[model samples]
Target: MNAERLVRRMIDVGALRFGDFLLSSGKRSRVYVDVKLASTFPDILEMIADGIAEKLSGVEFDRVACVELGGVAIAVATSLKLKKPLVIFRKEEKSYGVGGDRIGEIRKGERVVVVEDVITTGRSALSAARRVEKSGGVVGAIIAVVDREESGREFMSLLKLSDLIKAYDSFDTTKS
Candidate 1:
């Protein structure tokens, strides 16, 4: 399915909600996109993975990286769809472990793409980008399920990591 249809389903499935809401950035928002359903539903998740994989076509990326939690499944799916390796960025460095809070299977000078389930202020993705860059991964792009028309996209651009982000209206739909 296309992004439009995905958006319609997200709204129908209560994954995307419109209201006055407080964001993690301590900012108020008129919209909130919760995409757990899309990541969990087989058809929908495959659609999302396929869409993202298509976007990666012709792009030479050695690995796919995703932020903690939400991005985990999506990144894995995308990697599977593209037959590429997957790595996950944790919220915090592990107190003790082999790859706790690691940049995910990335080596110095490896190519990477950051994935997220949603974006609002873009802080999380930016933070993850820094870790990836600092660890020596060349970030190619940022992918999100929703843009939220907020500081998220700008934050990525400001960081100069990647202004290249892709999102669909799937998280913003009418007739809910």
Candidate 2:
């Protein structure tokens, strides 16, 4: 789980893009990190899982939780690697068939770590954490693959926006 290599891989796969984009959190930014793209490539996904697993070392957690969509693959891979139970929070509460806002159950007082593919304002990850808390699970930590740095919230991240920019610059330089 080398950071540089991971950034380089992201660059190669076009996961990191620079453009005017609107984030799910409703923030506008010139940088858009599409880690979901990594999910389509098993090797890239594995690398992310490896990096996340490495970061989780020494952190005590009973369940790994994540919001639906972007974080699913990363969370599933991490859960598999760490042998931890997975709890997935839905984007919205289900209206039918055992209606609920989440999949899997969290035992009372269980320590949970919320995972996110990218964090801008940290809304999605924090929302998932709040859900965990409401379900009697303690949010031990919040982790992300990339942090846009637009949000002042503190969270563990495998890469930062600056790191990606640096990687992109280096990559572009080599290409020229």
Best candidate according to lDDT = 2
lDDT (Cα, tens digit) per residue for candidate 2, span 110-152: 9999999999889898899889999999998899999888788
Per-model TM-score versus the true fold = 0.80, 0.96
Candidate 1 Cα deviation (angstroms), residue 87: 1.2
lDDT of 2: 0.90
Clashing pairs in 1: 7-170
